[model samples]
Target chain A: MTVKLYRYLEDAAGRWPDKIAVQEVDGSFITYRELDRLSDRMRDRLVELGIRPGDRVGFWIRKSIDAVATIFGVLKAGAAYVPMDPTAPPTRNNYILADCGVAVIVIENRFEPMLIAEPSAQGAYPAILVIGGAGGGVHLRAMLDEKDRHAEAPSAVSAPVRPEDLAFVLYTSGSTGRPKGVQLSHLNAVSFVEWCAEIFALLPTDRFSSHAPFHFDLSVFDIFSAAKHGGTLVLIGEEVGKQPLELAHLIADLEITIWYSAPSILSLMAQFGELESRNFSSLRFVLFAGEVFPVAHLRSLVKYWPHPRYFNLYGPTETNVCTFYEVPTPIPEDRTEPMPIGKVCSHLEGILIDADGRAVEKGTEGELCIRGSGVTRGYWNLPEQSRKCFVEVAGATYYRTGDIAKEEPSGNLRYLGRSDRMIKKRGFRVELGEIEVCLYRHTGVREAAVVALADDTLGMRVHAHVVSKDGRTLSLIEMKTFCSEHIPIYMIPDRFSFHPSLPKTSTDKVDYQTLKFWSGG
Target chain B: MTHESSAMSIVKEFILDEFLPGEEPSRLTPTTALVSTGILDSLATLKLVTFLEQTFDIQVKAHEADEEHLNTLHTICELVDSKR
Candidate 1:
């Protein structure tokens, strides 16, 4: 059966026209009919702007009802949506816009100043649709006002959006310092969305809490799965999500039934949010991904919200949650190691291959490789990097997830850290090579090594060890200032140490193990 | 010491000892912007919040843990006093 991603929104709106489709933390709600009508107008406007099939549309807005509407509208217009984090450094946002060759950008007026100040903003796109006020671009309100002049909703476009067409592109850090966009097709997203609907057994009565940012892959399930099942999606704003206590209260106050976020956020709530005192009777499921939840913290979370079904999902953004493990009710006391990521989803297949390209036997450690409908098409423009990761294995194309894993006898996969320099900090996949490249941009830095120092609370903190040039000195203030200008605030190293020279391995490469140890010292 | 005065001292000591180790305690005052100045990032702010909750026996609501409430030494002391 042919499927388009927008069909989820259309089907839900048809089934439950008056149901609350999306809700913001500030008590704003959009009914299914309103969501449908607004997105239809947006789709007409996009088509009018010459956004054709297979074109890329970008969004740099915060989580709001308009953001959700824009996503569905882009899909309906037969173009893929690219979401850039509004809080990301302007440099990063501009790079993504240029890299994707976005045909149009939908941005909020508050973000217009940052966009205008970006050096890469000059002629980056042909058009910009400002969400709030008039700002050097087409005002979205004007477009909707023009549409309102017509008595009926605009007729659906005849643009052919096949299942294999691009749906959205999510950018993740690459080892080469430039962010690479992972392209997911309509089929890829729909497979996961359908599987989620089946597994979660969602209904119109369910209320889904969306805690991940719009740019994060976790939001894909939060948006599409809820839309597909006709469930109300309550968006937890970034500021609210940051406050563990506020987030806990939101869950309780909204009676959110299905909750999804990073383990670090849940850990904070369990530790500091007084979760035990809250009533989560309406909460039925708690889903976490991006990083391994420390078993101790997981146990504590269970103690507080024991009635909810807890699941640990595992996958990079490329595959959008291919594996999951349901935390057994009454977690065993002797469980010491981090929770297992469990078996592959019903719609996907996973394999563990050793260093020599041979499939390792069960219980042997090897790189996790996934091949299935959920796997993304590949990186947006980097063919070389895409070819390196997406390879043909036994005649089937597989995305080589650089993660190391071992399969248990019970068919569960135990995650052993990454095989490369990529680490998850605060549920964000960070490439150490990316930070090293930023450090090298400084003239006074000769060598730089970045490592992750694991923390129970923050998941992991980045520490940078650098070697100064022959006659230069480096200060924390200077280094931080330079990094903040080039990268996102989250990617900035938490701690910095300067040395005359870095420890080198026998192969003459920087000894990251030594740096990690020295960081402890 | 008065409750507010002791709370301020506790916050000051923690900031000096944890974030600005070995630095002169006089470097920071009640109105210094710890967050905007990059002295405390997201993780550090969380750490500071946990410290405040434990040391002052006050609950720093997640919303109150942001820059508006905890950016300065004085604001942090005020948050603690209000919660207490």
Candidate 2:
């Protein structure tokens, strides 16, 4: 068995040297042999730049074929790659880089000023490698070309990376006014990928759709599944997300055989894509996760594209697709409740524990806990927070997902929403407190509270309550602009309710319940 | 004002008031890249569509609500005028 993910790519390159491995929306592609050589060049470049094993490397560029090269190259150099969301506010990305101690980052020329000017960019700056355009950093496009290498094809290079070494770090919404990095090792992800290959029966002929950003865990299944199976990865630009019809056309046009993304996207295509007019016969498996699949949308999608098998995958960033439920064929029309999360994956052991951390009996509601090779090591640089979520029971360490569920008579685990204030907005996990923290950063704000407004169409919309400084009333537009500069655009509040003072609970904490009640649920 | 320019001003005013509340008014010209620059997300685009439907009595088809037609104030006005 391969010790790291890059080795799988090496394995694939050895078999099918001329086969396409990754492709962009423009239809440009890189074959397995070319991808291997390019990644080796990237590894050689990083090594020349002093990137060492266990170091953190980040990429602030958009999703493309070169971005895939960066991932494999970083791993080949025994470093973990931190993929940043380019659309996210640069301040947050800078903070993430500083927090994770990124030794280097791959960025485009246009983003250099923002990264340098941001307040979070203080301290020792990470070396930047520019692609596409000129920046103050070294131009990376030169080395990516095969012309710089020897005439003869170079064999695949393997680093001294161990199985337990960190492979990647995903920054998620943290409760404490910032984002937390969820670190996963090669062993942690390999187990999940192997399980996925076995469960879905992945084939080299399958063309997996890559829609999610590299930062999202959903991309894990998309990127690795193709490399592991020696299949082609089709990149879909995020711009198509707003144009559901275009998204539908891309899926059909790309001939995507294996599809995976948040259910909201599938719902969007079904609601407005006019999918019946298009062809989706290429899809063999369609996996949706990150939020509940509204039955109405699922039914409409099936009505249009029924060729693919549907699966409801459930897990947090800390646990990679821990449980899944294959949607039963011909969903009953009268069914109102969403489908259960189904059984845990074969590689993991899941248990339900009470408020006191004791295991609960069958058919009883409890917090879902997973202990296995799939569970990721907790947040980077956050020992206290990691200690809290990852607890030991009977010598095996389990990750507390903070999700409530119960085992049904059919032996399936049914999801019962979040046990805490975390909510899914457009299939992305968000902490209400994280928004409040951003609002409080503004000097114009005195007190701030955030609550979620659940909407069927967009998963959930954020509603914020604020009391401005010195009795001044803050305009909704000003708050929106301020929040947009500090947080992700998706995390922006849908509405702002100005208050002279916020109501408090009996314990003196801000009354989120009252605020939620005021939002009319 | 001419009908095209009148429609353009109304749409631009609505966008500034909604998506770019505190920004300078001169920034949102008729040719400004609203959708491409992410001044309008899907939800924001839907909101703009709702406002236009009620104000101008024009329906935006699912295909019409894409980057090509909805990317700028000029194209959006063209879409509104065409639908009308």
- TM-score versus the correct structure, for each prediction: 0.90, 0.90
DockQ, Cα level, model 2: 0.25
Look at candidate 1 and give me any clashing residue pairs: none
Model 2 residue A142 CA deviation in Å: 3.1
**Model 1, C-alpha of A462: deviation from truth (Å):** 1.7
Runs with alpha carbons beyond 4 Å of true place in candidate 1: A116-124, A133-143, A146-158, A470-478, B1-14, B22-43, B46-61, B71-84
Candidate 2 chain B has its poorest 10 consecutive residues by lDDT at B32-41
Worst window of 10 by summed lDDT in candidate 1 chain A? A133-142
Q: Residue A12 lDDT in model 2?
A: 88
Q: Please give, for residues A1-521, the per-residue lDDT of candidate 2 as tens digits.
A: 67598888888899988999998777788889978877887887777667888988988877777788888989998899999888788889988888888888888767867785222234655777778742211234453453346342243455789888999999999889789999999988889999998899999999999988899999999989899999999987666655677788888888999888998888888887888888888999989999888888888788788668999999999998999999976677787788899999999999998888888999999999998888887899999999999766667778999999999999999999788888887667899889989999999989999998767777677888999888776755456667878888778877778789999999999988798898897
DockQ of predictions, in order shown: 0.28, 0.25
What's the residue-level lDDT of A370 in candidate 1?
96
Identify the CAPRI category of the predicted complex in candidate 2.
acceptable
State the lDDT of candidate 2 residue by residue for B1-84, as single tens digits: 899999988888898888776666776667766664456878678788889899998778756877788988889988998987
